[model samples]
Target: MAEENKQIAEQLIEAVGGLENIESVAHCATRLRIMVTDKEKIDQGKVEELDKVKGAFYNAGQFQVIFGTGTVNKIHTEIIGLGAPESSSSEQKKDAAQKGNKIQRLLRTFGDIFVPIIPVLVATGLFMGLRGLLTQEEILAIFGMTPADISENFLLYTQVLTDTAFAFLPALIAWSAFRVFGGSPVIGIVLGLMLVNPALPNAYAVGSGDADPLYILGFIPVIGYQGSVLPAFIAGFLGAKLEKWLRERIPEALDLILTPFLTLLIMITAALFVLGPIFSIVETGIMAAMNVVLELPFGLSGLIIGGLHQVIVITGVHHIFNLFEIQLLADDGFNPFNALITAGIAAQGGAALAVAVKTKSKKLKALAFPSSISAFLGITEPAIFGVNLRYIKPFVMGLAGGAAGGFFAALFNLQGNGMAVTVIPGMLLYIYDFLPFVLYILTNVIALSVAFVLTWMFGFNDKMLDEVNQ
Candidate 1:
């Protein structure tokens, strides 16, 4: 197995114009991301045809070859062992930054800032779903109990699990943004904590009219930023910049004391008096706009977003949705976008499954089956780049499936208790109620059936695979 992996690695390096043409190489969960010295020298067709390779694409300045999860790791290790310059994901990202347009770079930055924070959010979402399941009236009745029968302490404990992350979400965002922006992460945490300080009026309380904002200079309204994304992000950016600037100018002897002191003093003042209030309004407006779109008549919004979601994933810019989904969960405690996008994700699996069942070639069948399984399990790169996308019709059929499913999701007013997980594993988010669970299942079924049937009928045949292989 090791020798075979080494041979595959060697073939991959040669396919991409030899080791000398390679600038650096790295791997993510599923792809071997390579930055080459010259794009013209690489043979994409040969790379795609190589043994153990699933598919290949160039995006954000990297030539990414899908090799499944464990397989990609082995190939990457073999590549490094064969004298290729091994690069960290961070270094590869830097190379990517030098290639894409301004908007692409910005979206990638948002991705970097949020990717580390998603696991906590996902766990919290699961906790919330579990709490909802336990507290549902019908579920309780089945167990011969009522909400009142549940222990108050247990309820409080559930709240701790579900609420703490969101209650101090600004801190996490700030800390992450600070790290991304090259600032002191500990300082960012301190700054973020100050934004949600118990001393100030709560932003949610102020919005709900339960508490008035504390006035600064008898005019500027001061409120703690709780459950806010934009405010913390902006504050982190400005704070990091200030800290970096002060570090450069401060004397070495007093750098530690003076840099943080001056940085915090300036940032806290700017954040409370300026950034918080301004960006809070901006954030509210953005959320309001998204809600208006989501509430569009007859599920038009879902149809449009769902059809285009995977197309965006192909561009590698889909991570921007994390910000929107996070904001939705923070403000509304429910994420409808999660329900809408799951259809798109499910359709990818469905389309891949169709191709897997229809293909005759042993090699194509081998790639398609496992790739479809990966898609059903909530990772779609293999199914997408490997199978469905290679056959253009299947990808389009998947889009149609997504549109149909999304329409149902919006029509039924489906909302998830959490975000992150999707497809089969995403069933956890809908277990809160029988009706929601049923609707979630129905939506995914519609998506999967539509994609699978359409692709089986029109998307694949043995001839196409034979031609590609030839």
Candidate 2:
């Protein structure tokens, strides 16, 4: 079976231009993405003939040969060994056109790593940030909770679910990483968990008010990447490699035993001592960069991330930031993720709103209006994929409007610290001293309304209305 599979893999590689014609290879749930220099060079017919290639596709301006779940990476290696080509500008343009896949692949990557256990992350972060706004004394006044309210069983239950995510964020990342990369992320995660766990010995008892402990070389020290990105990513990378090697080489007879044994030994030592801490530092540096971006002139950050937000979502990399946002809520009170997402939804909704007004096709109009409303409520997938993505002018208009909304919203310091929904009004949460909360709210409202109006006025207008009146 292995020999036959290898031969088929080799045949598949040869059909796709001996691998040299290929560029980079990536995969999501259902597809294998291969970037090729000359699309003409690939023998699509021969590739289709391969038993391993369930189906074939060409997308994102890239030549893609689809493969089922675990098969992608194996074939990818065989293809790379056969020789993939280097990328060029024209190739880059083609990949750009395949924007949707790029987004999907990105999200699948991060989501694959994180989605299994995101509810805790989201609910916890939301509670903590919002709770800050409703402190002990404030909670007592607003909700009429006595001092006992702080220790109430209900509150404790809520804290357990939410704080669990925060306290062992890196461990969760490690677990997600394990799913993605297949090493002992469990070890990395546990190491991280121990660091933040109040029950653990000393566990940063040395620190005062967020001075966070940092103990090296003890019980496999791992820099907590809880609510972090880079550290889990790095550990997962190593773990996956180790896991893959173990999966392929370890005997099936002792598979369960040896696989984890080897995986844990290699992954634990590497992650705890190396990847865990190293990537934590890297994560911090990236956060610093994000802070710099956030601190930039209000409209610019909005314009950039807002305009790019939907685009990023399409490529699936947006979840990387979704994870990043969780990290943001964990370490800081305010987060740009929700605010930026609000812009994306509004921008997309504006485009769909135009289509609903302008398209002659009943089908298009039917899809557009409802979809637009959904995006307004913070659900952008349907509008983006079913409407705006299908139409060029509307999408561009939406993007422009989004950029404008983001720019001004950021300018006005409009933010939603908790449970930020997609609707324009969600920005109401950021109102505070030194923040132009009211101004942001008004300007953003104007920007989206104007975008919808302009889209209809210029190209999306009802020509039939005039003819019928005449």
Candidate 3:
């Protein structure tokens, strides 16, 4: 495997115009993110055909070659051995700055901020699911106890999982955003601490009217930025720029002492008095817009999201939904969006399986079967890049299946205890609710059946398989 990775890395470096022409290289989740000195010198088609490469595309000022999860990391290490410099902090900031138009840059920044924080959220979400399961009436009966019989310490420990991440979310977001925006992360973290100061009223208390926000200047209200994303992101950007400004003006002798102090003072005051309240409102408006879509009559929201969710995945922007799901779970205790996305994922697997069952090519069948299994495990890239997208018709069939399944999911108001994991891995999220669990399986089955039937009917032929071999 190490030898294979080395060869793939060498091929990748050559395909991207050699180590000399590359400005920087990095990996994120599933792709080799590269910044080249000249795009025309790179052979994109050759990169796509390389062993272990799933797909390749250019977006946000980077050429991204997908290698899935573990493979990308090994190849990345090999690339470093082959003399491609790993991107420095400054290089990352420059790449981020070069990303796209204003809107795309903002979206990309949002993704950068949250991608680092998702694992904790997923772990906590799973704990929440487990907590719910242990406390369920049925489960409690089996244990010969009632919900009240659970120990206080155990319940408190559950809060350690379900509550901690959202509570300190600002710190995480600010730290990442500041790094991405070319600022000192320590200063950003200090600013985040100020935003979520122990002295400030908890955001939930303010929202629930159990406590009042401090009135600043007799009008503006200040509250802890808990479960808030946009505020932290906005504040991080401002703070990073402010720190850079300070670094430029302060003398070297005083830089260490003064830069962080002044940056924190100015940015914290501005966040409390101006940016925090304003961006909080903006965040509310965005969440409201999302709710409007989900609340649309007759499951239209589900049908639309289910039908189109995988398209977002293909573009690699589905991480944005992590923000939405985390916010939803923090505020509402459940996530319907993830439920719909699960349907889409299952549909992809189903369509791939159908193609696997029908194809005459041993290689295509081999790829399709395992990709389908991977999809069922909540990782769909294998099925997507290996099979469905290649055939085109299977992908469309998957979309149709996803729409049908998602329509039913929303119609039943199915919700999960988590955001990230889905399909079999997602079963934990619904195990506490009998009907929702049944509904979850039903949604997958419906997606699989529909996609399987459609793909079997019209998606594959011997001619297509023969062409694929060529």
Query: Per-residue CA lDDT of candidate 1, range 1-470, in tens?
Result: 99999999999999899999999999999999999988888899999988888889888789999999899999999999999999999889988899988998999999999999999999988998899899999889999999999999999999999999998999999999899999999999999999999999987898899999988899998999889999999999888998899889999999989998998899889999999989988998998998898998898977987777999989888999898999999886899998999999889889999988887778888988898888877888898998888878889999998888999999988999889899898988888788988999999999889999999998878778766666
TM-score ranking from best candidate downward: 1, 3, 2
What's the CA error at residue 379 for candidate 3, in Å?
Answer: 2.6
| Highest lDDT model number | 1
Stretches > 4 Å off in candidate 2: 1-108, 125-155, 182-225, 247-258, 314-316, 358-361, 389-391, 417-421, 424-444, 462-470
Decoy 2 TM-score against native: 0.64
How far off is residue 358 in model 2, in Å? 5.3
| Candidate 1 clash pair list | none
CA lDDT, candidate 1, residue 122: 92
Full-model lDDT, candidate 2 = 0.61
Q: Which ten residues in a row have the lowest lDDT in candidate 2?
A: 200-209
When summed lDDT is taken over every stretch of 10 residues in candidate 3, the lowest stretch is 88-97
- Full-model lDDT for every candidate: 0.90, 0.61, 0.84
Tell me each candidate's RMSD, in Å, in order.
1.3, 11.3, 2.7
Report the C-alpha lDDT of model 3 over 1-470, residue by residue, as the tens digit: 89999999999899989988888888876678888778888898788678777667777678878777788889989999989989843465467567567876666667777877888888877887888788898999997999889899999888887888778888888888798888999878888878888899988899999999999779999899887887888899889999999899999999999999898888888888899999888889999999999988898887999889998888767877877887897786788998899999999999999988998877677678878988899988878876888778899999988998899899998998877889889888887668988999998898888989998998866677556546
Clashes of each: 0, 19, 0
